[model samples]
Each structure stands twice: as structure tokens, then as C-alpha cells.
Target: MDELVERVDAEDRVLGVVSRRDAVREGWLHRIGVVVCRDGQGRYLVHRRAEHLSRFPGHHELAVGGAVGVGESYEGAAARELSEEMGVRATVCLRFTFLNRSGLSPHWLAVCDALLPEAVAPDPREVAWHGWLTEPELRQALGQKTFTPDSREVFDRYLASRAAPATVRNRCP
Candidate 1:
């Protein structure tokens, strides 16, 4: 499949056109997938990207992620990537959205969360390694540079949304 692409300004406004690969490579405009998985114990799953990935290779990230394809909804891309990368199925529940414009490739990120029954089988091609971590552990990982900038933002947002009393109550009930 052709990589998804977008045109945008310094402020991330639609401007012209470009290829998604170029956006990531050249730091243009693209979309990112942010998937959050929570286990029964309330811990979240995180993974390290494969060293072979073009960008931020070997960086820690959420359990599954990818670029949003052209004409594909963020939820769809998240679901597809989650299944492909982790061998875990889930219905993506959109939790946060952000537009990052300072990077070489600006991007609109759609972050989603889901619950899983157990640890997933990680595809070696996509994920180098993975583990379950609590919110504090994840924060420490961020401070230690274990997570990429994009993943850090997503993790922070996911934690904030999930920690809200209303959200937690609804999930447990």
C-alpha cells in the first residue's frame, strides 16, 4: 500500500501535497497511529520498535502503532496495526488527538485505547521487545529516553484520560 501523505503549513494547515514516506523521511506532513492496551491489573503494554524501522528505530512505544493510510480512518489503521503487530485484536476507542508541527515531518496523531485479555505475541519484524508497565514506570521510561517523542505524548495523554475518575469508573463498572 502507498504510504499516506498530507500537505500542511508550519501550523499544520493543509497546503499542497506530498508522499507519506517523504513526509517521514523529509519531515513533511503525515499521520501517526497510537495504540494503548490495558491489562486486567490496570497496567499498560509497551514495546520497543524494531531497529530496522526507518525512523526512531529501537525506540520504546505503545504496544502497536503505524501510519494512517490514505482514506483510512485512524481507528481502522489502529485496529489493523494492532492485530498485525501484536496478534491481539481490539476495538479502538479514540481517547486523544494532537497536531505536532515542529518536527521535520509534522503529523496529526490519533491515540486510542483498548483492553486485552493477556500479553500479545509480538511480530519480530515490527517490535523488538515488549512488557507491561504501570503509569509510573511508563513515566520513568519517558524520562530515560526509552520512548520516542510521539510515543511519549501519546502515553501521557492516554494516562491522563484513563486516570480520570469518570473514565475509570465506567471501565470497571
Candidate 2:
């Protein structure tokens, strides 16, 4: 498959153009990633980016992720990344919030979270390793700057949303 790509302005507005290589080199692309976690069984998945990566080499990040290729939706990108980076295929549940890092460049990000089975395989070209992280461990890693700024932001938002109270239902007004 062709590499993912996008076109955005300084403010991260989709400008309707997509070029895989140009986006990475010029930093004007939007990307998507999936964060897979398990329940009390203690299974989760994270990927260590290849050392040869042009950006954020050796840093640990959520499961699969990559730029959103032309004519592809954010969810599509997430699913594609999951399969490409981890060699796992499953349905994904996407969230509405877009964890964008505009300060770095014209890049925007669409982050998603999901649950997957234990079976997983990492791609050597894009990922060096894969592992599970506990909530506290994940927090500590973020505090220590072990993750990329974008990853940190996405995780923070995910945690916050999980802690938010659900709206009470009103019956029989």
C-alpha cells in the first residue's frame, strides 16, 4: 500500500491535497494511531518506533499508527496502522477528539483507543518492540518524557475522559 499523507495549513485545516513523502518531509500531514489496552487480565500493546525513524526514533507509542493517506478516513488509517505495525487485524472504535500538535508543524492527529486479543506481531521496519504498560507505569513514563509529546497528549485526554462522570438519565419529566 502507498504511504499515508495529508495537506493542512498552519492552523491544521485540511487543504484537500495529499502526498505521502511530501507530508513527512514538509510536516504538513495528518496522522492517526490506535491505543490498545486490555481489561483486568493485564494485556495491552504499545510499539517502540524503529531507531531509523525520521521522527521520534526509539520512543514507545500506542499500537499501530501512521499518516492518513489520500481519500482515507481517520478510522481507516487507524485500522491500517494496526495491521501494518502490529500484524493484528480487528475492528476499531474511534473517538471524536483529535489530539493535534500544531506547534510542531502543520500536522494534525486523530487518535483512537481499542481492545484486542493477546496475539500480536510487530513490524521491524516501523516498530522495534511491543509491550504492555500498566496505568501507573504509563503515567510515570509520560511524566519522565518517555513518550512523544503527541502521544502524551493523547493518553492524557484518554485518561481524563475515562474519569469523567457519565450523564445521569432523566426519566418521566
Candidate 3:
């Protein structure tokens, strides 16, 4: 809660840096960078957040991420999160960026995807449990409230991005 995070407006421009606690308490939009790791087999890494986490504890997440630092880029944040959580360094591409208003906290979530290397060791403190899940399995897991709402929103957007024609995808609003 005391972590310093970048604060942004509804339009996703960085306003300044604020404590994570203040941002959530005041409903200020902040930046969160998420990394969705996919193995060579195309299964995504899904994890249960540690119960001790202040936000979205014990919830299923399609990505591993956290608030972006004051001076960090979205892509950098995503890569850092992947390294921290999975103990593997990998390049992550920014797939999309959108304002997430799900649940109580609103944030400008930048979703990134990474191809997992051969090594992966989930951090026990951050990830209580984790496994590779197919897209269908991921969809099925999202039915419960135990899944993070913003992540569900991300999944929806991900699906939309895949199904939408390239002509339409360029005009995301």
C-alpha cells in the first residue's frame, strides 16, 4: 500500500506519482502493467494470488503484474513483473492498454504477452499456485468471483482483439 505508483487520468496520461494507498482510496486512475506468459504449447500461465495480498487476494489471475513505477514504461514494468513472479527474464510485448474500471479500483491496465523460456519458478509469496491453462480452461476459471474482475475484462479484450479484423482493431476506442 505504501508503494509509490504512477497516477494517470482517465485518458491514461501520467499526472504524477502517488502512494498506492491514496490512489485506491481516492479512485484515481493509475498504471498497472500485466504480463501474460504463454508456453510453446500456447497455454497461458494462470496463477492464484497469495492470500496475504491486500488487493485481489486468493483470486485467479491470467497475468502476473503490479503497479508501474513512477519512471517506468509499461513494457518495462511488465517485464519486471514477469521476472519477479516467474523467476525468468523474457521480453514482453505491449498487446494493449485500456482503462480498467472493474471492482473498486480503477486503473489504466497495460496488457503484455511473453513467450516463456524453459525455466519457470513461481514465487511462493506472490503466487500461491500456478499452472499452464488452455484458453478454454482460462475461460471456465473466470466464471467465479474469485477471479479478478479486471483480469476477466482483460480476457474479454484479448478475445476481442483476436476475433476483430485488423481494420477494426486499429480503431480501438
Superior candidate under lDDT, 2 versus 3: 3
The Cα RMSD of model 1 versus the native structure comes to: 3.5
What tens digits encode model 2's per-residue C-alpha lDDT throughout 1-173? 44646576655567766556666567655655454555345545666789998778988875467667777777788888888877877766565445375334546665565667776777899888777777777777667745665766677666665555543211100
Question: Please, what are the lDDT tens digits per residue for candidate 3 over residues 70-155?
Answer: 89998899999888887889888777888888866888888887789645898899889888888888878788548887878888
Q: What tens-digit string does per-residue lDDT give for candidate 1 at 8-110?
A: 5556455655677677777666666667888889888888889998777888876477777666677888889999999888887777667865334668777
Q: Which candidate is the best by lDDT?
A: 3
TM for every model, in the order presented, reads: 0.81, 0.77, 0.89
Worst 10 residues of 2 by lDDT: 164-173
Clashing pairs in 2: none
lDDT of each: 0.73, 0.64, 0.83
What's the C-alpha lDDT at position 82 in model 2?
Answer: 83
lDDT of 3 at 31: 90
